[model samples]
Each structure stands twice: as C-alpha cells, then as structure tokens.
Target: MATPDFVLDLRAKIGTDPLWLCGVTAVVVKGEQVLMVKRADNGAWTPVTGIVDPGEHPATAAIRETLEEAGIVAQVSRLARVGVTGMVTYDNGDQTQYVDLTWRLEWRSGHPHPADGENTEARWFDARSLPSLSDDMARRVGAALLPHGEAEF
Candidate 1:
C-alpha cells in the first residue's frame, strides 16, 4: 500500500506508534456488476479505497478515490457501511487502524482501468460471481445492494 505523505510525515515523528485514521471505500455499481481493484501490495481484489484527506467528507473521499484509483466517475447513492475495517501492522512495524466509511456509489461514466499505481488491475465483476473478498468487503457489498437508508455503523 502507498502511504500517504501525511502519514509518512507522522511516521517520521512517531516511529512505529499506532495511528487511527478515517478511510473511505467505494462500492461502485453499474447495473449487476461492481467494480473491484487488484491491489498492488497484496494482489487481492477489493473496492476502491483510500484515506480521507484531512477535513474532507467521507463521501467526497470515496468519489475521489474511485476516480483516482480506478478511473471511474461515480456518485454516492448512500452510505453503505461505517466501521473499523482495517487493523493492520505492516511488515515494517508500522501499525494503523482505519475507520472505513464505505459508500454505495452509482457509476456515472468511464470504464474500469488502473489509473494509479496503488492498483495493478481494475475491472467490473458480476455482483453474484465476484472474486474472493474478505469478510469486510463482502459485508460492505451486501449493504450497498440494500435499499437506500441511513449509513450503517
């Protein structure tokens, strides 16, 4: 995973101290297909995700991430899931937890492509025949398919 510059700066000051951060993921749906990205770091398929920039709304971050990472323009239909989704310790000893705010986004334009180095591949998958996803990804996708409502926590 590419560490954000702000995070790298904090790491320089705090060493391996744990940091809690807000992040956003986009469950981008176009008809029966959902967009997924193959991560450069782990090669696992996941939704377009990124850290919420300081002072940015999670929904805005979700839209930005989807465009930046997968070259897809989308509009948030509703908040899908909001909870702690990533609690990880990197091989370098850096530890972090992400409060993942996921959104159900409707694809508005553009095809899937890896627009950034964070992902190696980006493609749309049949919602019913998706590649293996972590429990967290599965939960978010399920929530996104539900009728619009208040953000889940």
Candidate 2:
C-alpha cells in the first residue's frame, strides 16, 4: 500500500516514533458471502481495509477503500465496531497505531478484483468457510455479522 502524503510528511518529522491514526475496515456482505482481499505485503486474507484520510468520514473511507482495493462498490449499512489496534511496526520501521472503525456494508455493484496494488487478490468467500483470519480481523467480521444495532466499542 502506498503511504498517504500526509503520513509521509508526518513520518519525515517523527521518524519511527509511534503515531496515532484512523483506519477503516469494510466488511461487505452479499447474502452469505463476504468480500475479502489477499494483501500483497503479507498475503493475509482480510476484509477491505485502509487508512482514513485526514478529515474524511470513516464510513466514506470504508466505501472508498472497498472500491479502490477490491474493485467492488458497496454502501455502508452501519457502523459495526470501533476499537484501537496495537502498535504496528512496518518493514521500514515506521511505527503506528490506529483507532479503527469497522463498517458493515452491502454490496452495491461491480466485480471483485485486485484493483489496486495493495492486494494480490480480491474475491468473495462463503462467510461460514472464509480463510483463516487474524483474531483482530475475525473480530471485525464477527461484529459486522451481528444484527444491526449499536456499534461494538
């Protein structure tokens, strides 16, 4: 994934010091299937995820990321989960953490593909038989699968 210009600027100033940022996870559902992406960096199968741009609404970020990363259009159904992630140290040694907003989305249109270089594959999987996901990612999907109501915090 390309680093956002704003983050690059911040990194220039702070080096590897941990920075707090906002992120979004889009768990798009089409009936019993869920959209997923195979990340290029780690080959992890996960729901469409991205950094929320400065000043962008988290729900809108979820929609934008789904289209950009997975070549699928989706509409946010509701906020699913809000949680903070543990610090992440990237390959380049840039350390950061995120307050993630997970959104439950409904498929709108478009075929699934890896539209962006961030992922090597983008496709839908049966929700009951999805590839293994990290515990955190699994939690995001689980939260989204719940009946619509207050977001999990």
Candidate 3:
C-alpha cells in the first residue's frame, strides 16, 4: 500500500510512534461472492481497504479503494458497520490505530485484479467458502453479510 502523505509527514516527526487514522474497508460483492485482496505486505487476505484521505467521505473512500486495489468500480450499497478498532504494529515498527468504517459494496464494472502494488492477488470468493482470515476481518465480513441493516458501535 502507498503510505499516505499525512502518514509520511507524521513519521518524519515521530519515527515509528503509533498514529491514529481513519480507514474504510469495502466488502465488494457480486452475486454470492465477495471480493478479497491478498496484501503484499503480509500476504494476508482481507477486504479492499485504504486510509481515508483528509476530508474524504468513508463511502467514497471505500469505492475508491476498491478500484485502486482490486481494479473494480464499486458503489457503497450500504454502510454495514462502523467503529473504532485497531492498534497494530507492523514488522517494520510502524504502528497505527485505525477507526474503520466497513461498507457493503456492489460491483459495477471491471474484473478483479491486483491493480496496485499493495495487493499481490485479488479475487472473488464464494461467500460460504472464504479463506481463513483474522478474527477481526471475519467479523467485518460477517457484519456486511448480516441479514439486517447497518450496525454502529
């Protein structure tokens, strides 16, 4: 993933100290499959995600990230879930806490591919047979798949 310019500026002042950021995760769905990306940084599979740029709407960021990371144009079908979560320290010592908004998205056009260097692979998985994911990610996806409406926390 390309480090946001804000993150780079912060890192210059604080080195590897933890930073609080806002992000969006897109659960881009087509029929019964969900789009997923295998991250280049750690090879872990997850929904399309990216830091929300300053002043950008979470829904807009979700769609933009889906296109940027997976080569698919999407629209936020619904806001699935929203909450503050995370305090992760990467192997490189960069730490971040992300307040994430996860959205259920509908694919509009284009095939899935790893368009950005951040993702090593991007594909659609049968909703019932998804690959192993971190508990947090599983919960996010599950929230998007819920039979009811949006969730807030």
Highest lDDT scorer: 2
Model 2 lDDT vs. the true structure?
A: 0.94
Once superposed on the true structure, which residue ranges of model 1 sit more than 4 Å away at CA? none
RMSD of 3: 1.3
Question: Against the true structure, what is each candidate's TM-score?
Answer: 0.95, 0.98, 0.94
- Cα error, residue 116 of model 1, in Å, equals 0.6
lDDT of each: 0.90, 0.94, 0.90
Candidates sorted on TM-score, descending = 2, 1, 3
For model 1, residues 1-153, the per-residue Cα lDDT tens digits are 777899999999999988999988899999999999999999999989899988888899999999999999999999888889556899999999999888999999998999989999999999999999988888888888775777778
Which pairs clash in the backbone of model 2? none
In candidate 3, which residue pairs get closer than 3 Å at backbone N, Cα or C atoms, i.e. clash? Answer: none
RMSD of each: 1.1, 0.7, 1.3
Candidate 3 Cα errors over 4 Å, as ranges: none
Which of candidates 1 and 3 reaches a greater TM-score?
1
Q: Backbone clashes per model, in order?
A: 0, 0, 0
> Of 2 and 3, which scores higher on TM-score?
2
